[model samples]
Target: CKCPLGFEGINCTDNIDDCSNHTCQFGVCIDKINGYTCKCHSGFIGKFCEITSQLKSSLLQNNRTEILSKTCTPEICSNNGICYEDSLNRVQCRCSPGFIGDRCLMLKSVHANRNDSYMKLSKPKIFPHLNITMIFSTIQNNGILIYFGHMGHIVAELFMGRIRVSHDIGNSPGSVVFSYHTVNDGKIHELQLISIGQNFSLIVDRSYTRFINNRGIRTYMNTSEMDG
Candidate 1:
């Protein structure tokens, strides 16, 4: 008995699958006569076709090795955003939907500006209470991490650095400031605020601050606008 064209056993019982264990990386491995062929995938080429064509093209354009320098690391852009360097060599981040900020770390907002930013939400069926939670990291000593507006009025605001909750109740403004560890050390910090009935509390890390609303005996009596 003789072995067939694509077989190599004593009775042509074995079929040669050259793609076994062959690392194609970015291509497919095709079996051939006496050997195998690498079918390079799109944007890749070489003998094994494992090299990225984009990198190869850059190398051929000029001898300057700087063309191959990658400014954006794999982890540089958060939330599946593309990281690329502009013509001025500044790193830029393109964030996806529901994400913002320089590194795509911020949740998308309705209105944004250097002075102030806000997110407007549809009025809920009930407005008896408000609760908020946020996680952020910044070195700025002041900023509004969260704000809630109801009936064309500023109802609540959570400030940065020192956790503060300012609110308006029946044409009177009240605030509760909590002394806690600041998040200006380039680390993420969690802040939570809950308002129910005639009471509210602010929590930063392990520190807690609570305020009670006294209808007859007012602890704080001031009418002012809260800053964000």
Candidate 2:
């Protein structure tokens, strides 16, 4: 006798399969002579494996079913980052406070000793317009504040209880001095230097002094560096 669709027994009398259309849904199918069985995959259970486990189904539905494969692996994100896609759909490496950068690779600050300590900074491009201001309290009457350009062509120095800024363009050299009697009295003082249209001005405690050099070559604060 010829066997019917799901049955392959000699007499075709055994109902071995409980699967649908001889196939399993979210499960595996097995033959039982004249029938088949549905061996449900994880998180599913039923005669045909059609029912979802209550707790696990809710978890998957709430967490987006499609992105289950896009999760961050434990080895992927550094610095203990709980990886998740941001609203912009871009991956973000969330960093804690006092930490920054995409991978949290930078620290905000480092403790340093009082003497022989320095911090490094990236070099920046030069701009034409410039204004410099300094507020300081010093007991020394002779020291350098700011020096720049080749051979210290431009400088702001403290000499003999006075703040002096000297600039030289071609052969025309000029200096502006702000002599405050109490400058070295260990009191805070403000000094500002402003450059515009080949001219510079010095202001000490709101007292303004304008210096006009020989009107020939236009000059701006050109410097390879500036340091104390």
Candidate 3:
């Protein structure tokens, strides 16, 4: 009795069904000329192979019953972020810019720049002031609008460098709105100043800005903050 392509016992009579025996949950058992090979499934490895391919995969899935049965260990993701196992049984880190550690507990570089210069804001300094210059161009028929929100007071200035006339919102803070009109093509410049005592501001530069104000409408007011 000879074993099948990937099974091995005494007389090859034993069917080394990787799936049935839970031997290769993450891999396929490939039958070789002499003996059967346990092609461990993704996230699993070893000969007869019971080792896990991913390190952190077991850690993140600690509460699951399936993981407890396996010989693999936890602590997969190196960074502090969540550990995600790929289709190849490999582990990956969904890490943030400045931090780079196995469990994401280590800091790689405190001031690492990830993207364009226009999007970086560091420390808390108001005197020097941060300048952001953006170039926007659109066709005549295209409707473009800019929208922004802030927790504190701030002044925003809009300029239409092109021949087309651009709408402008005043120095008022909280929420600012602006639209582009006239001429087929144009250029606009926007300057935003973060006022004193203000903590954070969210600015969105886009072609269409939608404003939903329920000033005239009346709705029930709760004694406490609304939690949905």
Candidate 4:
């Protein structure tokens, strides 16, 4: 009977213990069905002999799986989040709302909307790599609101009539940017509202503003204006 990959002995009964000698001298002695085969340790190869090869491929792969399995998964950040390994081998947490911390052991601030007048302008952007979602909401009066719970960084914009507001929360300009042009003439109040970040824009007449951008622009004109 042949033992598995790591074990070795007579009739595959003995384990080729590598630790006894502090390390395998030449190569690992893998016990087989009736005997054992010497898998030369790193840097050495050949049959019942000693030959060094610069291309030591087999030795490099040894114990790689076991070492990887021993790495501990990190548990950081708050709110029922998960731990993941970054490129630097550092563990980071993907936290939930109302929770935040280095090890996910602390509570974070909570902001909930109770007003029924407000509505979410657009759906959240999904990032599969970071396992996060970013959502943007808007109200008739409050402008745009960003929610980044598990997501890393988010960029959004909001527009109202001739005013445009945009922001990149994770980048330099953390606050909103405002741009607009005023139209004093009340006869044909043509205001163009452009929100580049949100991919939306709008044009408003005397009664209401028309929205445009990614969601498409619509003009909100009065009944009289529509009739004309």
TM-score on alpha carbons, each prediction: 0.39, 0.39, 0.20, 0.23
Model 3: per-residue Cα lDDT over 1-228, one tens digit each: 655576577876665544332333335656445445666555545564444444345456564344322122345443345566657665555654334534453333322122221222333233313333333343434332222222121233333522211111222323443334333344432322222222223233433333322122222112123222
Best candidate, lDDT: 1
* lDDT (C-alpha) at residue 32 in model 3: 46
Global Cα lDDT for candidate 4: 0.38
| Residue 228's lDDT in candidate 3 | 23
**lDDT (Cα, tens digit) per residue for candidate 4, span 1-228:** 667765666676665554332222356556544345667665555552144442134235544343232234542233466777678886666665433544443433322323332334444332211112232222333333343322122332334422443323223333343434433222333333333342333333434443332221221111222211
Candidate 1 segments exceeding 4 Å error: 1-117, 124-126, 149-160, 206-209, 214-228
| Candidate numbers, best TM-score first, in rank order | 2, 1, 4, 3
User: Which regions of candidate 4 deviate over 4 angstroms?
Assistant: 1-78, 111-194, 197-211, 214-228
Clashes of 2: 4
TM-score of 4: 0.23
Sorting all predicted structures by lDDT, with the top scorer first, yields: 1, 2, 4, 3
lDDT of each: 0.56, 0.55, 0.36, 0.38
Model 2 poorest ten-residue lDDT run: 109-118
Q: For candidate 1, what's the RMSD?
A: 21.4
